[model samples]
Target: MTYQNYSLKQLQQIDAAHYLHPFTDHKELRDIGSRMITRAEGPFIYDSEGTELLDGMAGLWCVNVGYGRTELAEAAYEQMKELPYYNSFFKCSTPTPVLLSKKLAELAPKNINQVFYGSSGSESNDTALRLVRHYWAIEGKPEKNRIISRKMAYHGSTVAGTSLGGMDGMHQQLGGAVPNIVHVMMPYAYELALPGESDHDFGLRAAKSVEDAILEAGAENVAAFIGEPIMGAGGVKIPPASYWPEVQRICRKYDVLLMLDEVITGYGRTGEWFAAQTFGIEADTITTAKALTSGYQPLSALLVGDRIAATLVDKGGEFYHGYTYSGHPVACAVALKNLEIIEREGLVERVKTDTGPYFAQMLKRISGHGLVGEVRSVGLMGAIEIVKDKATKERFSPVGSAAVAIRDHAIANGMMMRATGDSMILSPPLIWTRATIDMAGDRILKALDLAERDLRNA
Candidate 1:
């Protein structure tokens, strides 16, 4: 029952027997045994085996303040001792919620003043779905209920969130996607662009697809379009310059509400408070989690622009929506303190001018390797696509196995990275420095080398 009572082997045995992990191939994990993380501090996690691993993915793209922040812990402790369980429902609210909301309004895009709290990114996204549809319904436009998302864009794992997301694998297992949710082409320049096409032209063409989908579905039937600014879990895809601007224009032309899903790209991940600013898109509502509390506590929020909030309020009361733990006190307190630290430390500005560019430069070196087909980065988020034939951009067998191997190699080499298909991604903590990146690059380069050698030998 105690930490010292179980040896590593015993812990692994117990985990294999009892633990059911998300987004994991259980059988494969059982074969390999879990990499039990025991402790962490400042962008590094120490395994049960006492191996120090650089967290290249920022603990599921959260943990913006990095690991082991006693400040956040103390804040949570203080709030829990005083008012941990109060809800924002039934004429009851807490100071944490009020303070966090003010901080979010200050941090979010202008005109976005309302904040609806949730416990996870998934729940926040689900809230967006309900809110958007409800907005349309309240306007007596029940027919306007379609939500458009781009292919490969990750929203979350909940039923409505997965439906809003465009991953076919996640959808296929869930009895097809939810109805009225349409998918448009994602602007992945490396994979989707044609040879000799200009980035601008490609961007415009891709943006037009959104309009096309709206037309095909009939603009009157579309409720909103949701997207991540950099498409985090979809491989840290940084859309070309013209993509988002045109998409925003199209959304306006079609009278579709834009919902920027900043679950990963929000906070300081993209060198900006929200990716919408990074891309210059004006959203009617925005979904955020992850870095809100830097993963120190469980929290998420749906930021409703003044426009949406006004309409919803005028339309009716008894919104008949929201989670029980929405706006939980402890979560809000931790998030407030976390944001304060991010501001006091100038983490967002640091990402914009320093660590982000340095990280990009470091990643670029890893490209041009025979196995590296592409390297794409924006702010502190990026991905290196592994390939079997770089000349033709041919991906490896089993589609994403090469990237998986590269990730495994990185893990074995004391760095943690994520692989989505053949794309190996790195989204280190926003506070990561050039020194930390250099250390990560060492592991990444080794992973690339090992992947290349293994593929060739196989």
Candidate 2:
């Protein structure tokens, strides 16, 4: 049975005693208690207290088709009854996984036709890292194993994923990460751009950092350069137009594989099936998750491009990596239905044509608020920089504190947004409409006004 029989206080007591959350401070959590999300529908979630919250972050940037999708539920149920569980090992395979892989190939970029499944983005990323290195090893260049990533880029939380990522805080706790991963400057123009430098110039300069890393590591020693098309957990930092093309050019020039972590940007987050297509990146591999099953089930697919797939098939044998839940039948079934809904409803096109543009326009209404330094968006993904001085783009001291305050205020006002450092990020459901955007705007503006007052009083 669910927690429905227990009182809210009882549930909280049990949770604080036994449950441990990811990336959370248990001491502080014990003091405040957990917010119980009892149910969700459309773009709104309901807590145990019966408070209705507009999920502006789309339940950790996954719930693309929104909550309460009965079709996805039925898909999982049917699959469970039919082929509950099976392993692809020992020459055994399941029909659901096979069919889902075919569907994913059709939806992925032109060159990406093969898929390696896992249970989460972290697992898929681990698969990508191993596969890329394995490809080089099989090609008789075992020395070419170093990977270049970006500072502040969020890939996932696994050892390999964390090593490939550039978050300093996560690295501090890692004690020791996987070796041979290097980080370069990200294409974040707002903070990194130099005095009087155009966006185009900054992008080129950022891309040059990749080339510099390759040269530093010796191009022959570098296996691949991996990055998110739009830095997602890195505050939805969208790169300038000149950024990706130059990055692609540099990787191509050096013959280094270009891997993309689209865990947060895949499945129509950027108005396309994949952000690589949106940004014109000819990636050799694309790691995807989160929205693949719309968070209804845990699943991730590492879309393998022809170049790497061909090498692995032709040269590499028994590369030796995968998970038990890799291509899980139920998860794959849910994902297929989720994709069907996305296509049937034309959610991708909707984000591209209608709601995406309107969402940006609505954000502009509050961009001039006292607490807002800048507001930016692409498709349904957005970020609002909170600052102490608007003119100088000066942030409040002790980064992330001010954002936490603003986020609390936003949640109390019935909006669910994420505070990543000093940036308020939003990646609402693809199903969110103009009306939902309006509601979110009103609540956000209220929170901003409250935050301005709170900061001034402090």
TM-score of each: 0.98, 0.99
* RMSD (Å) per prediction: 1.1, 0.8
223: Cα error in model 2, Å: 0.6
Off by over 4 Å in 2: none
Q: Tens digit of lDDT per residue, candidate 2, span 213-234?
A: 9999999999999999989898
Q: lDDT of all predictions, in order shown?
A: 0.89, 0.93
Q: Which ten residues in a row have the lowest lDDT in candidate 1?
A: 312-321
What are the clash counts of all predictions, listed in order?
0, 0
TM-score of model number 1: 0.98
Candidate 1 lDDT, 1-458, residue by residue in tens? 68778899999999999989999899999999987899999989999889999999889999899988999999989988997697678888888899889888988889899999999989999999998888888888989999989999898999998999988999998996678998999998888998999989999988889999999999999999898888888888888899999999999988999998998988888788888888888899899998899998889999999988999777765788888899999989999899999999999999999999999999888887889988988889999988899889888789999988888888989899998888998888987999998888888998888878898898
| lDDT of candidate 2 at residue 368, scale 0 to 100 | 87
